[model samples]
Target chain A: MSPQSSVLYDAPGPRTRRRTTIAAVLIGVALLAGAYYLVYRPLEAKGQFTAVKWGPLVDLADPNLPLVWERIRLGIIATLTAAALAIVCSLLAGTLLAVVRMLLKEQAKRRYAGLPAAAAYALRGLNTALRGITRFCVEVFRGLPVLVTIFFAWRISGISDPLWPLVIGLSIYNSVVIAEIIRSGMEGLPRGQREAADSLGLTPFQAILLVQLPQAFRIMLPALISQLVVILKDTTLGYIITYEDILAVAQQMIQILQNPIQMYVIIGAVFIAINYALSQLAAYVQRRVSRVRAHKPAAAATELAASEPVVLDA
Target chain B: MDVLIDNADVFVSGFWLTLQLCVLSATGALLIGTIVAAMRISPVPSLRWAGATYVTLVRNLPLTIVFFLTSFGLPELGSNADFLRVPGLSSVFDRLGIDLPYFRFAVIALSVYTAAFVCEAIRSGVNAVPAGQAEAARSLGLTFRQNLLSIVLPQAWRAAIVPLGSVIIAMIKNSALAGAFGVTGELFSSGQNLTSSGGNPIIPVFIGISIGYLIMTVPLGIFIDRVENRRAVAR
Candidate 1:
């Protein structure tokens, strides 16, 4: 359509382009292989490779495996606690923020049209500053590695064991993401719905809570579910803080028992099960929500129709 | 302050090693992931199953566990340690004069773990591409690969970049876990050297390591977000 488009279409003959692309890919693969050989072959030659030892892994059944079970239990406890905290805190914080902003928007619309120009400018400035602060906070939290944040929290005065720091860090970081999802969901609501609610004499709080929040939640459920999954997986970062998450337990098992690889495989299976289960649950909830929402009007109308006979008989 | 300044040289070397491992492994995983993504979308049922299984396995598993599999488990299998038996392979490898066992293990682990998410991201990216684009390419007599490379991938890559970038950032962060492997080649000798020293300030040491990770992860995150924003604007 444009000169650039034509140039792109004409730049290389198709045959030449195909050959170059394939060649580039092949060369890249070969370079990776060569690099691997250069770095890994020598390490493999070391005694790092030993015959399969099942004894240490099997010894897990023995009651004397004190730290092993403690590590595993503590890790699971920490991960679950962190996940629950993040979800609850983020949902509450994000919803409150979204409601406050939406309320401010309605007030602005009502107050601004008749305002003097100077007052309008002041109002606009205040709005801009609020949005700016929200963005800055989100960027700062999201920009930092969750692990760094957790480490910072652990080092900062009050918190003791690594679990609290991890949970607090997760909550702060994930709240930003949750807030964004909420803001976007609020924006997605049709203007007509807002006008309809206003015309019905509904208060701003009533309209948002009764008319809007339900719909927004439905729209955002998928994102929220995926965020939960992310947070769940992110719990693995606890291993760094010595919080005894699944990975930490695996690390302890590997180090104390000296069967590093086998234990790792077992740990991997544990994480897979946890995450896969979460994903499946998310899919189930999504389907359930959609189906219920789809039938809402029909179900409501059917109930109304069924009640009409009783009203007439009475 | 004096100790930190004294250790600046080790810190810089560690930074370089971190970059090397992250970039190399990210690239390797991206390649494997792209292939798996293709397989996930392939017509063959077996390929699709393989892709699905791989994505499920890697996406769910803790990356450290995968790293362990590479660093320690492979040797137990016996096959992983065997010398190159390819025609003229051993001689060529020798001529290059490279020793790469640790590199290979790291690459394998990082790539396999990364590929799972890559598959998910790329699959979603492909899903985002309108069916019309593929139809247009096919109408032009482009074969499957050509259609994929020309029409689907570029568009899908745009959609895929955010999640893929997140996964890459995850890999970089997870690269710090390499310290736990007792591998000397890793970037942060944090877990080992700190624990071994026993008296060193653990907080500063960890904070320093965190800063190092921030240096690696933060910029990529900004870039990816920027790219995603641009794509949003374009669409």
Candidate 2:
């Protein structure tokens, strides 16, 4: 079999493929050597850096090693905590609002079914306001960059803590996104599903919690995971305000070390690895969730998909 | 406040330069990004791999690095230190028939970074189009370019609006980073100028920087949103 067919074929028949592979390997090796020369050698020549002391990554004894560890530790703590809080809070708030809107829609549909015309107009206005407010909040948050928002929080808010600023900024911005996701998910639900729940005498709250939310979360998991990745990246923005996140720490080291290229290359590799792992986790969860309801209808699947954030924040 | 008002011309001129930079870089980036995107989704694996790697490296790395690379490293590469200090590298390159140095580097970096994002946006947009659309166009005897330009692209562009909008906004924000190295008339320029002149609070300087971005982007954001809402209604 040709190399492309088996997905693991050893037959390297194409001259171009073989050349390209070799070239890529060489370039990678060259990049690694260049990095070693730029970063590792500079400190090594100074005698300020000891390889043995830096060997234990978690140890705080060595100045260089501690600084690196602290930066990574701070970055992880800030990002993971903020993302967890934002996801949980946003999911709850979004789901609640979605349910409320859904209930309102159903009530409006029922009341307008045989209503007096003037009364129906007032009801429509109210519904419009709810939708408008939801959209407006989402837009305001989405429109502003997360860095600016975080900066504002740090500048004006009572909380002077770096981590709080990141959490608050990311949470508020992501909450807006999460709400839109949930609203869309709710919209994707079939009228019949709600109608069936209603006909069976289930309260609106019960119908949403029992019949809708579980399925919506399943669809939303991948999008949520993607959002988590964005949240992870935004944590680096803390560096701008002297917030001591990983990127900030790296930038500081670059200034002190005077080796921009090597520092950035290292940080980029780390970021890519972290994000790749997160995405893989997301995919795995998505598959596991989907397997639980392999036979679900298109409407349910659509609703589930809607509940997840579609746009990956860069 | 009065001092700032008195030097309003400086601010205005700065604003103008910043606005120009934002628009110029955005346009340049979009064009570069589109080409990169095409290369990325090309049938040839080498082009596709190159495009993918470019986007991955650019997107994963911070914009500050790119800014520093052009601002600091490029000067060292060229023999003409005197030429590098000139407002535009065009003079150094003008000897070689090139012009527009300050704008060129800013635009190049902005385009390179933004192109990475644009590539992703375009790739996603292209992917969103069902395979059948291109297949149908192909089956009908339209050339590949003709099919892309006439049919595939128009549809992809529309679908790509959300991500594209975000990318453009990001470019506007990134244009400020250019001030860190060169381009004194940009948003970051005002901060650099202010710091050098009287040493106002950096927070306020950054705030001003952000406000400048808001003025450039918020309107564009509203427009994209209206388009999205219209699409939603149509659906």
Candidate 3:
């Protein structure tokens, strides 16, 4: 038994140990039988295990192997290209939107004692209108499915190239999501950071831009990387729009080789490998960030006490 | 406006299908996710390994690839060749007067994909329960299963509700992919059909489809916020 199991149960006695051993063996046998009956037999029956199906992907000696790898390489490039563009766009736009919303809220609260009453009222009205419109856009884009947004971008923009629409659509949806992440990250910071910025005579916009935003980005690095993984995964949706990303390229190969199962399995494994690596990076960053905070115990304690709980936005 | 009015039936039925997809997939995900969570927390090393492997593999793979695998791979395996011929399973579906191979495939894909996230959410919830709770239960001579069912899970579920709501909401959006991958009459494909063949203007058709999704998602988003706020207050 694992150490973690001790939380729920004590070390087993002889009889309990034997019982657990028997249970484990039973589960092992069941798992093996299930795998054989549900997976191997059916796949074998369809001759999916045959060398012809696997050769292009796995057999170094196969004549088609080089071409297959080349296509896969190109496909990966296309996928990364789209994902990178979308990630950059989303991050910049999302931060801008977050900052704008924050500033608008600040403006709404300010008494504007130095300004005339009519001018102050006009400024407040503008702030409210901008806030309302911004909120509506964020909510709409966030609520709509990324695919639907891509379709709308594709149709409305009359973009013939699938990559632009895919990028635009991903940007629109992910920007709002990232905005929420940034907002939460900012909220998670100690209130004193904002106060310090204010004491230094920085305006609300400058304080956010110089102090809060950078710290939020640092604190939220792990989450941002995870979101990158999400964007990378979503780039596959370009297949629906006929974008020649890796998945679409795999489909074309399947059409040629008549090996849908093998092709898809390969594609799925590729995705898993890339995304797993990205997630591991996110985890590493999270560990490093926390460790840095741990070194500053006094500051960390105060930060923790003052910070609001940061719930991940979906 | 005219396009939306003229095609009201399409939008309604499309969203109805989307709702069905979400409901079925959510139920399947919860069931499988709970089992996987149990496996992960079990004392047996092999079960823990199996559960970890399942979650890792599924979580890393894209939902689109999962959909493609089910749409193409299941037929090759002969599992979904004819849903009506699957013996005991067929009878249940037959009695319900429904047999949709593509829809079933899509549900399988969504459930399998979403179950990974659900497992993580549930495990986090379990982790949120203080160690003292479990230790106390063990000291009281409650067995692992009894302790989990009575003490751990009851509290874990309360913490899990917010994350689960988010997962379900994401599932509703992810279900849009099913419409593209041969599950017709869902919001996406209906919009596609209207714009391409029904001679409706593209903007209105998409706007109508957007509303269909928002109607499902927005309220759920609000409810989750409310629940989260209440939990914060309680804490």
Enumerate residue pairs that collide in model 2: A219-A304, B89-B101
- lDDT per residue (tens digit) for residues B78-149 in model 3: 776454344765444432125658878878889898898888788878877788999999899998889999
**Model 2 Cα lDDT, one tens digit per residue, B115-223:** 8788778767766666677777767876656877887789888878877887887677656656654665665566556755765654565555555666777898888
Q: Give the clashing pairs for model 1.
A: A38-B99, A38-B100, A39-B100, A39-B101, A40-B100, A40-B101, A40-B102, A41-B100, A41-B101, A75-A244
| Tens-digit lDDT track of model 2 for A66-151 | 66665657665655665666567666766666677666665655557577888888888788787678656666666556665666
Q: Which candidate wins on lDDT?
A: 3
Candidate 2 chain B weakest lDDT stretch, 10 residues: B89-98
Ordering by DockQ:
3, 2, 1
lDDT of 1: 0.65
Q: Please tell me which model should have the higher TM-score, number 2 or number 3.
A: 3
Model 1 CA deviation exceeding 4 Å by range = A1-75, A97-127, A201-210, A248-257, A288-314, B1-17, B75-108, B132-143, B146-151, B179-235
Write candidate 1's Cα lDDT for A1-314 as tens digits: 11212222224567867875776566556656774675456435654334333444446656545656567677677678877876787788878777776776665555476789899889977876776676667666664556556655665634667878887777777777677677666666666667898899999889998877876776667667767877777777777667767776676666666766656666667778887887787667666655665575534422221211100000
Better of 1 and 3 by DockQ: 3
Stretch of 10 with least lDDT, candidate 2 chain A:
A1-10
Q: For each candidate in the order shown, give its overall lDDT on alpha carbons.
A: 0.65, 0.64, 0.84
Q: Give per-residue CA lDDT, model 3, range A1-314, as digits (tens).
A: 33446798888889989988898888888998999999899899889999999999999999999999999999999999999999999999999999988888888998778999999999889999999999999888888999999888887888899999999999999999999888777877788889999999999999999988888887788888888988898888988888899988998898999888888888889888998898889888877777776676435633442222222222
Report model 2's interface C-alpha RMSD after superposition on the true interface residues. 7.2
